[model samples]
Target: MAGEQTGVGIADPALEAAAAPLLDKLVADGVAGKLAAQDPTLWGSDAEAEASIRLSWTTLHKSSRPLIGEIEALRTQLRSEGIDRVVLAGMGGSSLAPEVIAATEGVALTVLDTTDPGQVADALAGDLQRTVVVVSSKSGTTVETDSHRRIFAAAFREAGIDPARRLVVVTDPGSPLAELGEAEGYRKVFLADPHVGGRYSALTAFGLVPAGLAGADVARLLDQAALVADAIAADSADNPALRLAAALGAAHADGAEKVVLADTGSGIAGLGDWAEQLIAESTGKQGTGLLPVVVENKDAPGFADAGSDATPVAIGPATGAAKIAVAGPLGAQFLLWETAVAVAGRLLGINPFDQPDVEAAKKAARSLLDNPDALRGTAEPSAVIGAVEVYASAGTTGEGTLADVLREFLATAPEGGYLAVQAYLDRLDDASASLLRSELAPRAGVQTTFGWGPRFLHSTGQYHKGGHPNGIFLQLTGAADDDLDVPDRPYSLGTLQLAQALGDGQVLAEHGRPVLRLHLTDRAAGLAELMRAVQELAR
Candidate 1:
């Protein structure tokens, strides 16, 4: 059998033996009620955030059973109000869950998680008269979310509609956003459990309200999620979540630095963004983390062929491989990975609950806006290769040629390190990202990750700069065919996008990371050439 056809699968027979000892220990710990005890020292003796760490465990239980009435009421209310669409504007944890749920369930919802003007404009492009604008933020002060709220609120008013009547706010109790929602007379305000953290709040009001509003079966989803808690509490080897945790922890210890994930079924792919943030932010501190790289099923071999150092953990059915399959188990997946990340943190001896370095880039980007002089090197092409041109930072060694810079970057990657493909192009095709991932990792003999620009600056960007220093950064940028301007800012949306890229690159360099920037006159042709270059280098 490839894996458990019902829940999650870690089917390798050898891994069963390797994982038994750890699984036994963890099961014993849970059976003894240690895991649920909310001890801060679970990760380390000096761990300081016990209160926050303990809250995440209760989220599954509290959210699934207790919040059913509130969830149903809101769904009924939305239907009666004739709301046909909902636009959720949030970032990271607040936005990823709804986006995944909307995709899996085929719901009428749009998630705006970027500060890119193009994305914001597209999300609000629909008819606002029938759309409920959900300005969602756990803290109520995320710069991107706030910007989206202001822009859309004004647009609604300009259309002669009452902004308050068409708006809803979901936030923690008494948060600045909740207060503002009340003051602004939003149509409704849904307060989340104060103790639940954003990432772990998938089963909470943050996700349920939006999922319900979008027409998903909230009750069934909760029922499925609750089973995860029960299985975890059972503390047995047959327990799916605990077994997965054991495999992940044991694999990382055996030198599989990269935890490559690929979803086989249609529903499983939707879990990528949420899984990335969950694993990256949770275990990425202390310079050791099980880097969770989400790959499409077809592209699994790219990382699988990453020599001896890589560990490819399949999340879906593949053609020929004994691998884990967490596909088709939507609610269980959310809890399963959440459990795995916490367990991995314990095994790695790092605090799983805190994200200590996520604020640095935000601060850096804000500083760039306040001081234009600090925006790093100009966005000019240093060398032209067919349709592409390469740019290097001021002190970069391979100054004149793009190939030289790429070769230097690839060679300098530490043993077992990963390559990050950060594309800042407006119209990059998913096929292109997949192709790059499939072709790069094996040749480089290291794990590879890909994310579109500006969006990634909010997610894995933290790990690249602050988690560990073993990353090679390849930035791909191109000219937009069309550009949109911010409502009142001095720069166009395109300009802001470029500034964000440069600002993040600057931060990476200051941290002594390997960084290279490529500019393309024609993105399609440039991407093809890049793939060829990588293939040749690998040979």
Candidate 2:
């Protein structure tokens, strides 16, 4: 309710009405086909499946049905056991839904979505006595989740707490995680129905975070979700989710090829990243799909409003200049985007929820860890360069060229360590190439990574000015036309200008590192050029 807004532009009642028939068709098909045909073994009993669906639908509709007794029993058990913090450990859909619930419910919780050792170290460093680690995976073998679990378990052991005491696992009953949980003598384990895909598990523990936290009536949330289900089932064009899908589908069909997810708060900001994985993995196939772009809406419209047909799916309270008025609107926007993505996936004949490339990165990172010495040969030495040449024509063709260039650069970069940021990855390929070059460079031989620290410098002025500079620095900035006028006194373009002045080329110059400054009128184009130049220079 806090983040919803209405009437940025007048509502098209006619357009809304047109989508009803399709929504009806989809619901009927879903209930009669997917939901009805689901195997009992995968979802528990028939009654359990029905209950899960009802609960999911209810929450979507904002109703007040409480969760059934079994769920409540689990929550009570957790409370009685002195579990103050519940960690939902999973990746992608397995974790995103629960994350949304936790953020929305205002529960004190921490999520470990990354497999990075540093992240695991931080989690382990925290007080484990009161922590309940919920290791969630549908298949029981998400590489990242498993890796992090091992790290956390080792940490728990080091902290003197029995690993079982701090662990609760949610996974398919016969799956690896479930088997491991039982064998390891975990204190409690919740087995998700194998039939229910990770993305679709929200009705279960996936959507139970808010209910568990507020001690809110689970039944009520279930009721709300059930209402949504019923509405979806009815198949009327008035179904917001269905209509949204239709609108998004039409846009994609008509060639609006990018989706920009913008979020203001820390909790919801990560959702953008999750959405990126979802959309890209699910729909980007067969040469037709919206490139899912994710970015934090920190009063910056750079990524959100970039393309001509860019649609902003705003999440949670409008803390910035978007000035959205209601949570209902934000909810509507989400449903719209979800529908759009679903439709796009349908158009591409692909599943909108699964991500295959996600594992490749994990595998590569693991392999790099396995053979750290292999990185030495791949590492590139720092060097100055000249202007990068562009070979492609303008518009879409140019975008494709940039993407190819980025892929080529990333393919050759070393496995680990920080690189400089020339452009935000949410934008075009040139920016992505810059990021890949800066962040993915091999640390085997490099002494320092260079990049301008405008945002960090502004936010951490005291620390940067006084703290030790153990890393390399590269400063990048440009004079570009502003996308939006800042209305508040504190929000000025000059702030960025001053940040650049204080921390950009001159800042790196003072630190006595090899600093390079390239000024251009167009930020996006300039970023692209800088990326190409870096690749050529680094090569």
Candidate 3:
């Protein structure tokens, strides 16, 4: 039912009944009020210190008000200069929200969040004079972002255009990116609130800058969130956040750990993709957590049926259809999910503020980049299946085609474990790759997740390496038709991308998770062959 005050609807008698006691207990404990007050103690003493700073996300709707005018002014100035094309070069949290915001508003914003050489090349091929690159990095030193910034700068210079006038920087204050913005004379350097974590900074400059420049009414977005901000913090029977948290907690306790989300005419676009990260990264730690499975549509997965361990969730206004439904304006939706994930964190006994397992892959990537030669030692494909070179990372699988490797590796997947297809390919040029997840679902008979490269490393990567360790990994890499070289780095974009995939694969294999690395000799042909193999396997 839609909340008269918050405009968010959550209706499911089953979920409400199962979670009623938990919700009552939460209200009695004043979880919502404590969260609203930014009381770090709500998550217990162990998480207090971290939660203290992370709670700033709760205040962003108000604190971020000033950014609206500034962003609007930038957009006006860009438009005046005929610089209408906006290309966002960011990763993970810094990129996902803006992508959703722009898409929901039906605006055109080119998101360059991948290192796929073909993708980067395509982005570079855009009208340079009309392009304004928004480089966002919460850490300021993210390699993919740095590479993007460097390449774009070089491209600008080659076109006799001034990067200082075209590039916009969004980073934490006093960070390297901020410093670079100043030194390079970027058009604008928007500093984000330091207190807000990357994933939780959707309303911060990290999200606002890109979407605002891309012509989204970001101020209205803040207003929408503000409408529910107060209601979200109230500990009452009607509190959507608390109810959502309780529902997830209760479902997990009921042995339904996989939360499958489907969009049933929500009007809000890509909410699942954005929420996927928040849920996966926040609670996915300490070896016990909720795994959010984002389906392309309501009918894409079979989670709604009986006897399934998966909890079906609808992201729309309809009631009594799914076990739970979260409906609100895009802004309210973002905050609702964030708050629910935080509360769910406390329920699951983990610090949602920290991502301890995310660092392992980063360190592994850095190490691999230090010595490119050793990166190829384990990369020898076990078999050449047409356009794909398949490398069995889980141990020596009997030599066979790509389908055979998938069958063997998937069979090794624990009874409840899922299949994660990671594609480090150009999202735009190779958009067909996203369909692989849905296609593999019927064939594999397991929950499927498709992550587009390095971005997922920052989101679900924590869960894969830290959460339940029940993930079966399938990594897809493609040969860059044409590669772009980073100006100052010894490696090309292709090298960095390969290192990322190899590094994650190495780490997953080390952690005892089986990873089947498939290299696409010909991206288009390989994707077709791989999809064909999956369809054939289903027969």
Best by TM-score: 3
| Tens-place lDDT digits, model 3, residues 403-446 | 77777777877777788999998888889999988888777777
TM-score of 3: 0.96
Candidate 2: lDDT over CA atoms? 0.44
TM-scores, all models, native as reference: 0.89, 0.58, 0.96
List residue ranges in candidate 2 displaced over 4 A.
2-68, 207-220, 263-274, 314-340, 353-356, 382-539
The C-alpha local distance difference test score for the whole of candidate 1 amounts to 0.70
Model 3, position 503: C-alpha lDDT score? 89
lDDT of 3 at 400: 74
Clashing pairs in 3: none
List ranges where model 3 is wrong by over 4 Å.
1-12, 305-307, 319-321, 395-398
**Order of candidate numbers by lDDT, starting with the best:** 3, 1, 2
